[model samples]
Target chain A: MAGAIAGALAVFFVLSVYLLPQSYLGSIHPTRPGPIVTDVKLSQTQVVLGESFSLQVSATNSGEHADMQILSIAFPSLSSTDGIVDVQKHDFRQTPLFIKKDRAIGAGYTAQRLVPAQYPSIEASNRPWNSGETFSIELSIKPQTEGEFVIFVKAVGLPHNGDQAHWPSNGTIDHQDEFVSVYSVNVTKA
Target chain B: MNYQRGSLARMQESRRLVIGYTLVSAGILLAASGGTWDVTNHLLNKPETFFAPPHAVLYTGVASALAGMALVVSASRAAGQFDWSAKFLIAGVALLLSAGPVDFVWHSTFGLDGLLSPPHSVLVSGMVTSSIAAIIGLVRASKVLPAALIVVAILPVWISAAGAVHMFSLPFSNTAYFNFNPHPIAGAIVATLGFPLITAAISHTSSELTGRKFGILSATAAIFLFINTFTSIIPNEALVSTIPFYIATVIPFVVADAILARWRSPKSLYMAGAIVGITFFMLYYPLITHTYNKVMDNKTVWGSLTAIIYFELMGPLYPVLLAPAAAMGILGAMIGQGMVRRAILAGLR
Candidate 1:
């Protein structure tokens, strides 16, 4: 009997440590593949130090059904990691915190709040990408130095987030034309 | 065939042990396989429900291990048997089973860490303990075939103990998978997490199997784990590249067992632990670096003293890892010694 109690306590303590809520699970959406197109255009390919530039990105969901989410993340030209550049995109400060009781969201979401992130993992918009719909986003940046750098984009389709908690995603295949995109570009220093 | 003083009853008991041992052994393997495949499945499949297919297989394995261990114990207990060794084995596997629901809740609450995050570590620990249980159970039985199965049951855990993602798993060619060399990631994990934990486990579990048997067990354990880790990660991503084995990976076991033959104290166990954990990375860091350099065609990458100490090689290997390994070695050795002593007492009575 004593052993049983000890065992239960041990188990409970362990579960408490592991199962404790770390973050909110992001919503799971059914996404389509093609013609799920992605395009990123730079206002200037070459810029002098301290010159301001813009990146215009347009993503279209050309599918039969309504596309739930077409997400993209920005990689570089941030103030935190480097001081040579200043950039701005989504206003995460103004974005309301996604607060829901545990288990409110359906399966496939993780503990960490991913989509509504500070810098890298910010979504284009909270609004879903509809059928024959397109979402466009622009970022303005001013260089502080002369070194060239590639800005990276990790675009996640609805089913793009794989089943396992933090593994590489094999698209869930929720939609017939479901697609996952990874895009990047190197801007030159003038 | 007499009903009283029944030879049949004795035969039945003997049969139960053999059958139960087989079932439990098979079950543990299934569980290990399920866990490994689950990693890839999680990597490839959509964000999983706790009740995913791989998880289900793991649960099945846990259930089977529990039932099998129970059967073997009941058989032994019936014969005026039952030892602490067997009891410990049962408790270990039971913990492994109990971790399932906790793991489910963990996934639901915390989402995914993919590393031996939290409850997952508990699950792996349960596996380690249960594998230890199997070892103790077989040694108590003092049978050759069942003992051999103990070696198989304990295979695949070295990777778990090494705990850093894909330490012995994942290919060295992965250095060129991108611009950055990933061998540092592997080296970092082993040096920081795996060697000490694995060394401790090896020392603790190897209590009963001494002298030449200890040598055989470690050799077989390392080899089988190598095979299992290789096959689990090979066909999919070739993550199971055979780089570590080329670097005299078996030397630790050979060296440790030799020390144990003479000085069978906790001190020796500590040294043995350090030898295995320290040597693994000492040899591994250089060999893997050379391999990565060959692949990347760049000599200066991940070769910095900073990288060697912290990210790439020898930094986390020494006092950080070795000290703990030696400590756990002593602890494991003592616990193993105690368990062996208790099993002997029970068997004698």
Candidate 2:
């Protein structure tokens, strides 16, 4: 009887492990309400003063069942700092660029210069980003000072299913924005 | 004691008991191998699916262990003989079985977990408990079991106990849902104190049970080194530089075994235990470096680069740790001797 009970448990365990949904057992950071940044990579974290570095990042629609659009990827800190760094080049073509100045942002962020590094291509920018598809952004930056600096990267987009008129703004360099990632760059005097 | 020589012999020779013990031993060894492989796979950034081969092997061993425990319990009851080892085996099996479901729920809720999460702790704790059961079981039946089997039993006890210590000290237990990571100083204290204690305790038990046998401790230590080297060190190209250093660690184990065999006094036991205990840091090698990393503020990404990080940390860390670790090992040996004496008084042998 003890053997039989153990055998039954073994069968149950095997079934649970094999048949469970991938959403339940496989991955973390499940589908959210907006497009979320998935991965961020820097060409170099430490660069000589006045030298250039690049930031490569990707975002995906994290809506559980709804498709979202890739509106823009912004660096909200570069423009605010006095002379620490400057955005040199970006890969976004025929997209609008704007400076959001003196705007009180999300939680714990004092109002500073908010700069949109790149907006999505206009034709498909408003269309659904689609599930499993990613929006990649690359920016070349030059450090103007010889100290460590944090660049706050955020994605802005909205689920197509939502009826809100303007793009639902999710980009904020603050603690409340879970979709934001902070990248550090250390500049050395050479 | 109620057990006569004839009765003890009959118990050892019982066919069901023999089969039960063999199955349990094989099952645990299989699980230990799978656990090691699983950690390696995780390090390699392989897919974290239940269908992964390592998990299959580990769970298969768990099933086999469950079946073996059931058989052993039934046979012991039928013979009207129930000992502490059998009880420990049953409790260990229960904990092992329960850990599966608990771990599943934890993963489902928290997504990915680290080394020291609640469920993983329970699982390693189960492994330690069952290993102790096997060691005591084989030690008591030493007259009938071969020396090879006893050595095999000791291997799991050592690996599993090391795993249990790593669970608290590896500095990787925090997850999205919960922060299970212990403080760095706390982890350092645990590893510094825990590793030697485990090593010396196991050495003392093996020495006393084998009648201060000359080769048993060395044999078990050799097998452990070979297995860890094959699974952990040999696989990563970066760890190649540390191979000779890892191999050199077995000298103390050999020396300890020789000392215990030739000189059977308490003083020699303490000396042997300290020698065996000092080897704990080297015995665990690259993985043990994580605890040291925590205290020294060395950040690691824990992939191929981990080898370079461990090598750098070892130079500064080993000198500070050796003496305290040896002191703890002596204490462990005393505790282990006390355990053997208690078991003898209870007629386990």
Candidate 3:
């Protein structure tokens, strides 16, 4: 029995190493891969009360086969790292503490709250990100108060018609998304 | 009549020893599988708790190992003598059994901890100790088991030793409360030295046990690749591009084993060891990328997608690392060959 089991395992190992990559499982969504943030440059890390600063995020469709259309780009309300920080405790929608409002949003972008309790964000769906092509979104914001606040900029999109059966629509930004950039913004009194 | 009785007693003792060692080996395999799966689940950001399935599998394996050790002790008592190998097995089991309460106390006091915290370190230490015991026991009992079984027994030892290396090398031990991550340069040095050493030593030991066997080392590598790749790589969709790279990595192992099998000399063994040693990073793949985080200046978030990109980022720098890794592997192979030689001279083979 032991010898038979060992032989079976050996066969399975061989088959998996050689065949799995060639099989359909290997190319589940080969044509349409996900979007990735290549570079994120914050105009400034400090902002005075009633003063404005901008954050520019550059993203691209890493998968070379097809174009990927973005749904929303927002400063995610949730922290991706495992921690005790309660994001919902400070609901920016009800009463803005750090960011008062967007002074000027980027082209083809609308300023709104993706989630009810999420921070102020921008959304655009008309543009399709081409292979190796980079697109930038800059959000100029006005601060309302003083203190340090962490701002996480994230992008969520689909591959034009990406394998929706496998890649479901991510309606809103949450901690589950991986494409994000974290920034620490220190706001001082004017 | 007295001669007949003595012969029967000897047969019973051999049976008992074989059974005991087999159970211990099976237990080690189970524990190693559970540990690997648990690490994968953590990387995938799956919900984790003390009662998770992987933890259960791990504890069950630990229990089986303890039971097997107990049986070996009982058998040794009847035979009226205990071998040195049995002592190591007992010590390993004791350490494994003691790690639970240590972990519990650590969690209760510290609230939460990272991978290389004191309790986790103790647990990994137990894995290494028990893995060593299993390997030694299988070698001593080689007379009863087949060469294939003995060769397969090398997996647990290789994995446990790798785990021990990870304790110091990976930078995942930092939490909000404690910072157990090693210094970046220190981590890089340890990873570079440790992985090659483990690959060479384990591969050499497998070869030695099978008497310059051609496929023994290859078989061991194959099984390890299956386990690690299945758990860590196959699950994540983004890492699919790396599958071919992993399969390609095994070619060096095959080549190294063929060299050892074809030529029977110290120089040839050293050459084979060096060949296997350079494959350290490739064998480890995605998980091993974390070891080079500080050295490579990688600042991306550590998720599945980024892990793939981070791993690819190491390609340009790997050429610079291969030579030193090969040297360390040669040293490890020498030490491993010596251990096997001593065991054979002591009449275990």
Best by TM-score: 3
**Model 2 C-alpha lDDT per residue in residues B1-349, reported as the tens digit of each score:** 4569768756655666656766677677667767876776665444457878878878887887787788778878877888788899988878888888998898888888887777887788788788778666655544455677767776777778877887778777766678878898998889889999988987777777667778888787888888888777765554655565676666677777777787778887788777777677667777776677767855543343454455556556767887998899999989888887776655543
Q: Provide DockQ values for all models, in the order shown.
A: 0.03, 0.02, 0.05
Residue-level lDDT of model 3, residues B1-349, one tens digit each, is 9999998997787678666866776677678778877876666555577879888888788887888888878887888878877888888878777888898898888876777888877777777777777677766754644776765467778887888787788887887579999997899899889999988988898888878778888888988888788767775555666676676667677777777888778888888788788778768877777777667755432343344345444546677887999898899889778878887766443
Model 1 per-residue lDDT tens digits across residues A1-190: 3354345434432332122111101121223433233577778777776677776666554442321343443444443324332334433212312222221222233222223323332345323334566666666666555666445443333422343111124433211122233333334465
**Candidate 3, pairs of clashing residues:** none
Docking class of 1: incorrect
TM-score for chain B of all predictions: 0.61, 0.90, 0.94
lDDT of 1 by residue, B107-210 (tens): 67755444334466667777666765665555545434444554554553443443333424323222111222345445444444544455545444553544
Higher lDDT: candidate 1 or 2? 2
Please state the error at residue B127 of candidate 2 in Å: 1.3
For candidate 1, the clash count comes to 15
Native contacts matched by each model? 0.00, 0.00, 0.00
Number of the predicted model whose lDDT against the real structure is largest: 3
| Global lDDT scores for all candidate models | 0.47, 0.65, 0.66
Q: What TM-score number comes out for model 2? A: 0.64
Cα misplacement distance, residue B76 of candidate 2 (Å): 1.0
Model 2 lDDT per residue over A1-190, tens place: 3354345434433332232212223322222335556777888889998788887666665553222244334444345433433344433322323333443332211112233323211112323344455666666667676787566665544322232212234443343232445568898998
Ordering by DockQ: 3, 1, 2
